[model samples]
Target: MSAPFVLLHPFAPFPLARRTRWLWLGVAALALLLIAAAGQWSARREASFQADSIHRAIEVHALALRGAAAKYSYLPFTVAQHPDVLAALAHPFDPAVLQRANHYIEEVNRRAGSDALYLIAPQGTTLVASNWNTPRSYVGQSYANRPYFSDALAGRNGQFYGVGQTTGEPGLFLSAPVRQGAEVVGVVTVKVSLQPIQEAWGFVRDPILLTDAHGIVFLGSVLPWLYQSRRAVAGSDLDWVLSHQQYGAHHSFALLPWKMDPAPDLPGFRVQTTIDGKPRQFLAVDEALPELGWTLTVMADYASVTRARERTWMLGLLCAGLLLLGGLYWQLRERRFAEQRDARRELEVRVRERTAELDEAHAFRKAMEDSLVVGMRARDLDGHIIYVNPALCAMTGYRADELLGRLPPYPYWHPDDVEQHWHNNDATMSGQAALSGFESRVRHRDGHDVLTMVYTARLIDAQGQHSGWMSTVVDITEQKRSALRQRQHEEQLQHAQRLASLGEMASTLAHELNQPLAALSNFASAAKAFAEQGRQELLVSSLDETAAQAQRAAEIVRRIRGFVRQRTAGQEDCVVGALVANVLALLQGEMRQQQARAVVRVPADLPKVRGDRVLLEQVLLNLVLNSLQAMQATPLERRVVEIDATVADGRLHIQVADHGPGIPAALAEQVFAPFFTTKPDGLGLGLNICRTIVESHRGRFTFADRVGGGTVFTLELEVSG
Candidate 1:
């Protein structure tokens, strides 16, 4: 009935047939052993071939990297020899020379396709940069701490790769010292981006990685693997990287979870790692780049070698089975046919089941997309909308059908931002859109404006080819409204604090006005008496004094009004001396009441600062008031408040010093904290409010203990040109 039974029954009647059966069994077992050996040999040969191929690929990758760096190796030297750069370095403070140098560097950088080019002074301050016109310009950044700068200062060419401290972008920096005769005058540096290399590597099938000597991946085909260390990095290496900020301080330098073992029959190593949540094996080949002290690695998948080995083993097993079982082939043909039919039926059933599963998965994904609160949209490479989730339609008050197949300048684009939208769309199509997302305004159907943040990602098709862009948009209108409300609340609090300060000084204000008003009254009465006696000269003198007193009283009132008035903040050029005088004038009565003397030493030639005049005055007044309060317990002779102002290094510095009990070291930091104070009656908001106002003007407020058992508070502000 079966192949095996018929073959054995024929031999059952003869002892010799039985012996032949045993011999055949032995031969079959021997054949299996030979087949396994042949399969092992094939697998080993394939592994060796793959390893050689990987080694070759790694060598090519190393060359490409070296070539990229070589292209810019001479740029820094050329720039250093240029006349403009030399002139800029010679007269680093000359604006005209700096401008010319900056323009020249910008042109050269643009033409050379470099990220940045700049000249550094001997002290390591950036003199001019190609991006000097941008907001994050490196015109005045200090690089004395960088190893490259130090190397160049030592009269040697320097090459290093690190994240830019100013731009926060990773790049290769090449520096050359500018020579004046035999002495190095300054350093010229060129920055080049290596992102193009990484992008090109993504097109290859194998994963390629470029690692620094410290084993940190600087560039890789796998984007997530970039900036990660191949192995555990600690001790001196970690310190060096952190101190130099080689990969940026933001990177944690986490180790990749990789297990490596020497290949049993290959020239390279075998690496086991997880990629996309699936375990994978790779044959790894590494090539050293001595020029840059880097390593180029290629990871070739081992699945192909495994499949080849399986095919070899299958072919061998088929031949052995044919030779050993040839007698039973005819008897087993019908049974084999039956097995094939059943296998086909089972495959069909699996296909149907898989189809059903795919349908369910599709439904699940659709439901998930529809349930998302964040709007989803996708567009093809041609910028034609291909898909829109229900959330997107609801957000724009448009039907799905209306949004689908739309192009640039769509109906939902804000009327005022149609051109911007088109430009953004073009950038997306060209693969230049910012990955961090951008904020934009969208128009609703009911004529309302909606603020949104849109993040875009590449859409990859089943074949792993980039097809288009997928965008996730979130409505940030409510968040923006909340932020605005918070700002308004803070402004109100600041205004209230100003009012409270005025309230506290009410008695001093009354006393201050009393003296001027009394003097005016006395002068007026004298003038009247002299007029009645026909003393013309005396009457004229008295009348002049009366007017002077009245003006003084009016000035005090005006200062108080300006300080108390609430209005929109304004920015203007304010003289530092004038600000100090106004603050002292406002606190004159308080100083007199406390039996304290005010010493003003402001320079007449100080440059004006750019900020809100009234806000700056409030800051000074608060400091003066605090100083006066601190001196309340000091001896009357030592109860003096000194106010001094100076201009240096393009900044204005003002100091208020008082000979009083100094703040305790423990309380010094707490002084600026809100609602923290030493005075029992104080609300503790004076220093905090003063600091806030100063910082709002792009200035700093700091305090330190004076040498003579007192406190010195300093305010630094940028001087207006």
Candidate 2:
């Protein structure tokens, strides 16, 4: 049978009457016992509240720490992904590239507030440092023994808390792998100062300790033994805090007075609370911060509770004494008891009010939990799924009960993204990080990597215990797909525009080829006539003409090929005169076909320009061909196409003019616009891409009405003389 629970009110009236005096004494005694119990309960409750507050404060500190880590993570990733950095690292120790990379690293470190950032070779040699003041120190050091650098070299991003090889001070090291696709090339390591953490999260004035999985103290404020002190007791402090306390794994208000000596082979610590230097009863709760792999032990003075109990006992004793002393005094005692009864009723009312407040807080928290965008889950270090929130269930399309024990490390990661997923997870799980947010692929319920923006926090159970992790994941699948589609469409548009330009130049090109062929035919006919006449000298002359004609035919073919070839495909060297002469020759046939003759204005001598001769010919052909078409229906006395060439402003400038109707002012500019041609059957891409090609070659193309009654197309090309 359980002992009967007793309730006592400080203001309850004491029952006293002739026959009820004994019963009243018994009632007063019961009240005294109940008051003692209540005092003890209140003390325990206050202690628990303090413990909970401490746990909450630790969480805030961890949040600050994680925020810093997430910031640090982006630095190395940015450096590794930068085009200049990639080009630099692609080569074998190019001094110029390395110097540029060093400068880049310095700039990044300055922005990120990092103490040290450097690149490590696969063999663990420091290739370059953002700050090279200690060159000889870390430049040749072996990072093979360091887990972060080694793991990164093995194609994984890794992090760890360890002593700096160069500074010989404790620090958090984060490393990201530089990969050429699947192969890891180098490691970029960033070292962060823990001092910022101390500033952000109030600590050191209180007992704060940070430990790792190996039980080694990574950080401790105001408690040297918690870190740096090479003592077993310092390392075992966490173990002791866990074993000796009945604190819940959450925030609690409790005071525990206990001690343990974790010194190697030494008597364990002995600790407990004292009141005025005397041993006093105490209560405590354990706060675990699993993310940091540590716990907090909170203690307070329990003597005040004892004193309160003693006071209540003293009051009861005096009341009994007074009641026994008088008949007249009994009336006064009765009045005092009546007052006590009223006070008790008021206390009950206050308790109800406090309970209501607690309920309100719970309701607000529930609302917030339901509205959060990201999924939340808790896991143990061994990768066991312990708990999950409803948001997480919704994200994965799984019921809450199904996700309870399911490990979801990379369920939604694209096959290509799995490796990166593991690397990031490893970094977070290790105390090397606090909180991290990134754009990564998560597996959706529909089996696609729901491109998501995830903000993950290292889970600390209670005090500073290193729980696995909890993340808020927002699906960005639509946005990602949209961006991808936009990029592909842009590429396709560019390709189509290129092809359209080529199609527009076809007519100009036919004229170019026909000119040389016509010359060859004329030369062949002359040779044949000479052969029939048996004129030896004339026959020799005709043979020379035939040879020249053959050369002309070859030149036209080469020019046409160059014009149509992809810009990056080939190279050709020719003088400015030769290129211009070739364009006129090709267009001669088209000019003839259109009954238009070209007036060439090229000088005898011109500086040679290096380029694809064929492409240059194509540019001139297009201009001259347009001049021919412009004059086709004109009633001018002479349908003339004027071709002019000169070197001006360090560039080759050529113009083609026709004696046809002058270009309309409004349509002159619009002619160059793509797909805006005035011709009935035109694709309107010729001049547009002609300008595009010219600009690509670092030149310009423009048009204006000719001086007389036609249009003029101007071409300027940067000369490599």
Model 2 misplaced regions, further than 4 Å? 1-25, 87-93, 134-137, 199-205, 228-328, 331-721
Q: Tens digit of lDDT per residue, candidate 1, span 1-721?
A: 5989988986777997678689878988898898888888888888888988887887777778888889999999999989999999888889999999999999999999889998899998999999999999999999887888989999999889999999899999999999999999999899988888887898998788889998998888978788888887899888888888787765478887789899875666888888788898999888888889888889899888887789889999999878757746754775488777868988899999999999999999999999999999999988889999988888899998888898877899999998889888888788888999988899999889999999999999999999999999999999999999988886776777778789878999998899989999899999989999999999999999998998999999998888888864589989888888888888888888999988889878788899998888888888888888888889999998899998778788999999989999888769889988777777778888889888988889999999987899999999884
Q: Cα lDDT for residue 383, model 1?
A: 83
Best by TM-score: 1
Residue-level lDDT of model 2, residues 1-721, one tens digit each, is: 2333334443245533444787666867786677567656654555455545555656666666677667788777777876656766676378777777778877888887888888777777877677854444455566776768777887777777655656666577788998888888888889887765644323443445554553444555433233432233333554533442211241122222334322222112223434346554333233455644445433333345456556656775676567556654676867699678868988899999999998999899878887776676667776667766677777777676766666645454567777888876776667444354777776667775566776766678768987677666777778888999986664454445435444655675666657667877887788788889897898898778778777876776675555555443336556766766766665555565676776778776655565655555656666666677677787545788787878998787878788878777777658777788777776666677567656756778887766757777887876663
Worst 10 residues of 2 by lDDT: 246-255
Each candidate's root-mean-square deviation in Å? 15.4, 23.4
TM-scores of the models, in the given order? 0.51, 0.36
Q: Score each candidate by Cα lDDT.
A: 0.88, 0.64
Best model per lDDT: 1
TM-score, candidate 2, is: 0.36
